[model samples]
Target: MVFVTAGALDGPLLTATLRLRADHAPPGTRSRVFAVGAGLEITAATSGTALAGAAAGLPAPVLLLAVAASHAVAGLLHPVLRGTARSPAALSEATSASRRVQ
Candidate 1:
């Protein structure tokens, strides 16, 4: 259950990061993608082991709260990973719609 929750929260963010890197990388260059994969692999291995160690002997509610807090921190960092905002055209459309609503 913890793995499933974490995966659901992380999958799309990781996918978006990969897609963004792929689109911006040089044509025919897969090095960036590989780098991202390697980083994720390393992070998962170390963090998973550490988390498991910490959660051991902890109360179930405490572990769940820790997981939720970690996800919340990840959520906060997601916007930075998202890079720039939408294009001016999209921004203008959004503004116009809001103006109409007002």
Candidate 2:
């Protein structure tokens, strides 16, 4: 339990630090993408270890599977979400629609 707590804390703390670094980085989509990946990796790695430790009562293979799943969800899932938000023109579509309504 204690181990899990200590290790689990790694993700959020690292994420906050990464966010600050990301903010200071060049203002561009590339920076934003990097920041997101850094955060996700930190979270997945931290949480993966924590969860793996807690899996003592479970089967060994199960532990590996869970940790891998967590990593995938963190690293891959977030980039997809961020990717979908990339279309700057989508916002303009809303503005054009509003103009037409007015």
Candidate 3:
């Protein structure tokens, strides 16, 4: 399973993502430290998206702002969707029990 969020604006942008896998691990290792972290940041007079965002196919500046405002409102509702999501809680117990029998 995975989760992701991203936001962009005039000054800066923020993004985050996470993924969990239910794969096998070495014997006796109750838990594993998979790729625990990642990050990136860049600054310059211009950024790649700047040109693409201004190109013909893209929406005009005003339209873009309106779209952003709409998403800003929808973003507030994001938690409602994720609140019902589940993680691998009971599966860990089942994994350990099955390992014991093996």
Candidate 4:
């Protein structure tokens, strides 16, 4: 069903998101970062469920379009947000330095 398909699609995205969070979090704060990320994800899911319930009467096409639009916005934002993060070279150097210290 559609729900199963959606859940399957979400698997890789969730994994990548967690990996990215781990990569970006400060060395001593990875657990806190993951906890915060999970809490936020849960809050967002709850909010989305409430919104969907409230919009239950809306036409299916309209809801679908809204979902598509949100996806498009997220896709566009990804590059812009990524640009603000440390580059891969910097991250590798930091990792190497940390390994040396350990």
Give Cα-based local distance difference scores for all models: 0.78, 0.73, 0.50, 0.89
Kindly report which residue pairs in candidate 3 clash with one another: none
lDDT of 2 at 72: 89
In angstroms, what RMSD does candidate 3 have relative to the true structure?
Answer: 10.6
Per-residue lDDT, model 2, residue 34, is: 81
Model 3 lDDT tens row, 19-41: 23223332344244332222122
Which regions of candidate 4 deviate over 4 angstroms? Answer: 88-102
lDDT of 2 by residue, 1-102 (tens): 999998899789878977755554444354776868778987978987786667779987987787789788889889888887635456556656777999
List TM-scores for all candidates, in order. Answer: 0.50, 0.35, 0.29, 0.69
- Which whole-number lDDT from 0 to 100 does residue 87 have in model 4? 70
Worst 10-residue stretch by lDDT in candidate 4?
87-96
| Sequence-dependent TM-score of model 1 | 0.50
RMSD in Å for all candidates: 10.7, 9.3, 10.6, 4.0
Error of 2 at 80 (Å): 12
Q: Evaluated with lDDT, which candidate comes out highest? A: 4
Worst 10 residues of 1 by lDDT: 21-30
Per-residue lDDT tens digits for candidate 1, residues 9-92, read 988987986786665554434696568777987898899999799779999999999889999999998898767656546755
